[model samples]
Target: MSFASYHDNIELGDTVILYLSPTELEAITIKRGGVERNKFGDFPHANMIGKPFGSKIYAMNKRSWIMALYPTPELWTRALPHRTQIIYSTDISLVAMYLNLKPGSVVIESGTGSASLSHAIIRTVAPTGHLHTFEYHEQRAQLARQDFEAHGLSHLVTVRCRDACKEGFGLERVADAVFLDLPSPWDAVESATRALKGPGAKLCSFSPCLEQVQKTCTRLRALGYQDIITYVGLIRHLSFSHTKMQNFVIRPNPKGTNSNKRTAEQSEATDGDAQSVQPSAKRENIEAEDEETQASETAVVGNPGVKWAPIEFATEFMTGRPAPSVRHARPHGIFDLCDTPMLSYCFRGDGLIVQNDQ
Candidate 1:
């Protein structure tokens, strides 16, 4: 009795995260009574039954073993076959947050890329919610479609092969959010508005260049997409330098910190606690690198240690004749436009134009 496709336990046809080597891991679907052959050794799928989602699987000889885990969205991002350049999880997570993605969220994403972000987005809105994703390349779209089916995610995703910039998103005001990861995202700003839902529907564009951001922001303002903002989400990962410990075994953390559990025991002279306590280092040497980056974004616009050059535009783009005051953060600076209640952004004093009724 095997489950069709689920995330909790290993299923016969579900793709699992296979630890290929010390430095590499990939996604491979499990098959009943099937064998996986590699340099490490042969792994039998029949032996993986009833194991938890993240349990480790050993080789037949028990010498070379690998972790046979369920594919999480984060794991999927790292292990997916890169049909195109993909956005890492760090940026993807924050973007998901900025877009206010929850269960049952209907969103639009342009240029599926490796479908890295799409997988994450689909997971967030699974079971009921759906994602309408547009990809420029038909082959990439088809490949992504196949991947979704393999992961049992096709029910929550729609991969369309269309140029969102030229032909538009082809979706009405049904999107709770619109995320753009394109070369020229400015061309689709107008199209995104058509697909976005009612007031306060968040939108985000992922671009590597400041020029692209500026152009896209400009177009978004022109098209009445309010709360125009940007973001650069950076995530640091800690890497510990390892030494060769052949017999090293990682045990479950008992209860409390090592340092806190000691010394006071000598003062109190408690034998029961110290006897049961295990000998473990209080701290380990660590190093962190910012592996995630999202082009700086937010709705909380503020004067953060930068010279703001205000504009005196009169009736250029906005409807008001108060001469919309536009300000630019000087010298390649990034602006963070946060939420401002009672701040009329009708281009009077603020540079942003009012879009929705809110």
Candidate 2:
């Protein structure tokens, strides 16, 4: 039943997750002479003992089978009996991330409702770290302690029955982070400040309403907590699939044929018979035609009777023009192109041709 460590074989008194389907799961403790009955069939606890943790065991009737799974925080969350409203895996992940939780992180949590998040927190800060959780309900606090003990995590967590919002965490400068999930989390902010180990320690409060968040934020600010940010826990599922669509082709209408006269139905009917060319092939053909056109147009012959200046390397290389001469040249200081002489600029090395406009 140890969720803090891994074991290969299912032993007596150990909790196992029975995976019936993707959406169906059950948690059962192995006890001698114990039997579990579901819509599938009867599963004997004796038959599961000594078997591998992941074995697929047949029902007593032998008509159905279910897989035995190693208990992890995630699987346990899915299978654990709900004593109250519990946090799901999505929000649990965000809590861990925002709190900067890791191994050896001392965490303080208030109002351990169903021990769902408690299990996840223990799993995160195991081996050397510890969790101090408080619950206002006395029965839930006792059940949480028992649950932790059954999972072999009693050494790593401390459970107390007390209202943290009123009594505080009852300690100071001990926790690396504090988490609050209470009706009036703002009331507990002062306690959280005392529990945290001074600066750099984080505090998170989970509230269902924006009004509660606002109050919490105000209290945190008044107490000198910095870098306060609010977050809403939301989970969105996206479905992906492969979709195939028909490729289309476009061709110019026949010369002298009025395209406007063609009805939408007629155009659509002709499209079915049009040649189907793959996009890649069409792109290749267009590129090849462009290369040929560029090669043919690159060679230029100067107009007759025009004195052409010797081509400069920069102008010839950049503009692909062989040579350019000043048109209607006047005195060096004057030009008829404009009232004031215009200074034409050109680049060095690889540059475009500079032309003096008339």
Query: 40-103, model 2: which lDDT tens digit per residue?
Result: 9999998999999899999999999999999999998899999988888998999999999999
Q: What's the lDDT of the predicted structure labeled candidate 1?
A: 0.69
User: Tens-digit lDDT track for model 1 on 1-358?
Assistant: 1112365677677788887665688777778788988888888988786788767888898998888866778877778888888899889888988888998999899999898999889888776789999998999999989888877788888999999989999888999999999999999888888888878888889999999999988887888766776778888876755333232111111111121233443456466655543334212211111111111111113244323322222122233344333454221212243232111122233443322222
Score residue 267 of candidate 2 by CA lDDT.
50
Cα error, candidate 2, residue 329 (Å):
66
Best by lDDT: 2
CA lDDT scores, all candidates in order? 0.69, 0.77
Clashing pairs in 2: none
Q: What is the lDDT of residue 318 in candidate 1?
A: 39
Span of ten consecutive residues with least summed lDDT in model 1: 285-294
